[model samples]
Target: MKILHTSDWHLGRIFNQQSLLDDQAYILQEIIQQAVNHQVSAVIVAGDIYDRALPPADAVALLDRTLNTLIGEHNIPVIMISGNHDGAQRLGFGSSLLKHSGLHLFTSFDQLLEPVILSEAEGSDLVIWGIPYCDPEHVNQYYKVKTTDHQSAQEHVTQLLHEHIARHYPHSATHVVISHSFIAGASVSDSERSLSIGGAECVSADLFKDFHYTALGHLHQAQHRSYSHVRYSGSPLKYSFSEVNHNKGVSIVSFHADQSCNIEHVPLEPKRNVRIIEGELADLLAQGKKDPNNHDYVQVKLTNKEALLDPMASLREVYPNILDLVKVRNNEGSTNSERSRAQLARSEMDIINDFYHAMNNEHLTDEQRQILQNVLTELNNTDTERSSKRA
Candidate 1:
């Protein structure tokens, strides 16, 4: 059976306070097209369907339309769950109606026991065990946990799921587990929402040793965990500057009865690109002109002699998504000038003078100190003259 694994859609997400709905819509369209081209039996969205507990009206409309295209137009079954950023009750609405359309939405801990089972005439049955964003307290209440640690939470949930799976089907049936949590050895980007207060909430990949395949989510970078069978599909779009170079896409997995799987990455085409360019503004503009790539969302590291005035305004000339402009203040003639700028930024006038004096102190520069004194005296004279004129 063919199953395409994808997650962390983070619909309604914003980058640097700019709405990413357009990019997100484009990514989802790409996913649908890939599903059609591959003729996958099921499209599994591991979790994090939305960026917030209650998505906006536009986000809701977008999700609704996308699901229609997937289920109505493409005729593909979709199995999805809620993540830390989603509210279970909110996404769970109309889930009953959606199931009839071959879209299974597991949005709460109460439904973890119910695995969505699908089968084909060729005698292959695939069971998808959907575990939404598991909370220690909620899981304890649902499964009656004896402990609250990360391992205990996983053990409690997995044990219940195992018991159910074992009772329903034998080890012969193809099984896939879906979850939204951090796993050990998976790289996390800054844009992903944390599940707990500390990193201890993440479970080790060994917990899923029994499953044939695990489609995971929550991390924004596509990566394999401690187990090759366990993997994260990552987000569809670059949600942060840290993920400027990430190949945002989806994963397609083909399952066989022998418990072997083949995974492939399907590239996504986003509306805008996120890029980081490091050099002077002139050099960056020159490079952009020379290159064939589009400079949509860009972060420039300016290795310039001086800080540009209104760097954002200057970068907007070439790239619209100029989120950051890092100035590398340097020049052979302006070493002291750069230090002065740093000191002034910190409002440290005495420290600035002390540093200047110390730098020249060892050189026996009496002439330099006199020059500095004369400059300071002129500054004081100007202040006194301005104050008297104002009085």
Candidate 2:
């Protein structure tokens, strides 16, 4: 059985405050075309169907159109799950009714035990266990398990699913696990939100050892965790400037009759690619003037020592979609270096005065200085009062 694996659609995502709905619609059409070309039995959308819990009406409509084209028009079976950004209850609405039409939406924890079976006439059956994004608190409450962090929570939940699979299915069937999570050692980009603080969110790759193929989400970069079978399909669009180099695409997995599987990456071409251009202002403008990719979203870094008047406005004439601009100054004997030298020869008050001058482009007036002094004196007096109380 052949299956198309993709995730992190982030349907209503915005890049640099620009709406990506048109870009999203374009790429989703490409995905549908890929499905048609591959003649795959099913499409597996791991998670993150929307950019936010409360998506806009247009985003909702786009999703509706995509699903209709896939399931209604093409008659392809689609299995999807809700990611962290998705509101589970909202996305899972009409799921029970939709399943009759071959669109499987798994959001609840109770749905993990039941597998979506995809089979071909000649190949082995593919049993997919879809697990949605579950935080530690939810997992603990649902399963009555002691899971203090993301790793522990994932481990506990997966263990239960594994036991359930073992009890129900035979050993010969091909088992696939579709989950939304941050597996350890997977590459990350700037756009992805931290699942937890201090790295407590990363789950060990060994947890997926038993599955034939593990399709994961959460991370926006397409990569393998510990093994070839465990993989992240990544987001369809470039969500950040950091992902400018990523060859965004989808993964196609073909399961053979003998339980062996083959994985292939089908690259996706976006309407306008995200790119970064760095050079001096004059050179960059010259390059942009002749560049064929003027329509692409660009981030410019000017290496000019001297400030130029309205460089962004000038660049916009050539590259209309310039999203960000920055001036890179010389490090040696620069303003920072001069500030350091001045700080060494000055008192704390002098340093503070200079800082205020630099920030506001003006020095502190007599009235402002008096007000600051009065505030400082009050703070000192309050500290002294606390000390006296302690004594």
Candidate 3:
């Protein structure tokens, strides 16, 4: 069976405060097209289907239409779950009705022990275990124990999952575990929230020892874990500047009765290209390489002494995605004394160097000279104290 693994679509996400509904619609259409072309049996959306629990009206409409296009038009089954950013009760609303339309949403841990089984006439079977984002309060209630950290929560859930698999599949059938959490060794993007601090929420890699394959989400970078069978499908689009260099895409996974799977990455087309360009304003204006024709989001760094007049307005005339601009101040100390003083104070060596520069190069008042001497004396005393302690 072929399954498309995609997550963190983050529908209704905004880029620099601009709505990404149009970009999301375009990517969603392409995803359906890929599903049809590849003849995939199922599409598994791991988590964070919406940017927020309460998505915007347009986001709601867009998701509704996209789901219809995939299931009704293409006749593919979809399995989705809610993440930390999603409200389980809200996403689970009308889920019973949507199931009749071939959409399976596992939004809460209340049904964590349940497995959604799909089988075909060829004697091949798939026992998919869907574990949604667990709220500590909910998991503690279900397990009858107070799970304080993510590690404990994961332990509780994994134990329950193993029991469920053993009870239902008899330890002989092929199974896949789908979950949304931060697994160890996975790269995190700025778009996602940290679920744990100091390894509190992290689970061991050996937790999925019984499963044929593990499909994960939460981290926006698609990658394989220590086990080849465990993988993350990552986010479908670049939601933040931290992910500007990542290739946004989906993974098409094919499963066989032999318990082997093949994974393929299908790229998504961006509505507007994201590019970072750095140079002096005069050079950028003269080069005229910031194509005005295409709608591309751009970050331009002005590597000049000062910023030009209305730099954004001028750049927007040539590049639509000039969402951010930064003026790179030259290294030469500013003529302004306050600016120089603040910069010099940032570094220990620079403080001493600035003092000496003032002493030898610039004329200074007796009061200013005495202040610099006092600062140097404090530094010398601190160094002497450290040396004495070491000795």
Best by TM-score: 2
Q: Which lDDT tens digits does candidate 1 get at residues 315-354?
A: 6766756777777655546678787777477623444444
Per-residue CA lDDT of model 3 for 1-391, tens digit only, reads: 7888898888889878778889889888888888888888888888888888888889889988988888888889898888877778988888778777889889877667666677877856887878888757768886789999876787789898787666666654678888888877778888897776676767666787568888888889878778877888888777777788888888888887677888888888777766677897656765555455336676788885431456777667666567788877765466678766765557554454545543464445578767877887898999999999999
Ranking by TM-score: 2, 1, 3
- Candidate maximizing lDDT: 2
What is the lDDT ranking, best to worst? 2, 1, 3
Question: What TM-score would each prediction reach against the true structure?
Answer: 0.84, 0.85, 0.82
lDDT (tens digit, per residue) of candidate 2 on 197-279: 99888999989978999999888888997889999999888999999989899999988888889999999999989999999
Candidate 3 Cα errors over 4 Å, as ranges: 286-294, 330-391
Instruction: Tell me which residue pairs clash in candidate 3.
Output: 297-321, 298-321
Which sections of candidate 1 miss by over 4 Å?
A: 289-291, 329-391
Candidate 2 backbone collisions, by pair: none
Which TM-score value belongs to model 2?
Answer: 0.85
> Against the hidden true structure, what lDDT does model 1 obtain?
0.81
Model 1 residue-pair collision total: 0
- What lDDT score goes with residue 100 in model 2? 90
Please report how far candidate 2 places residue 61 from its true position, in Å. 0.8
For each candidate, what is the lDDT? 0.81, 0.88, 0.78
Off by over 4 Å in 2: 332-391
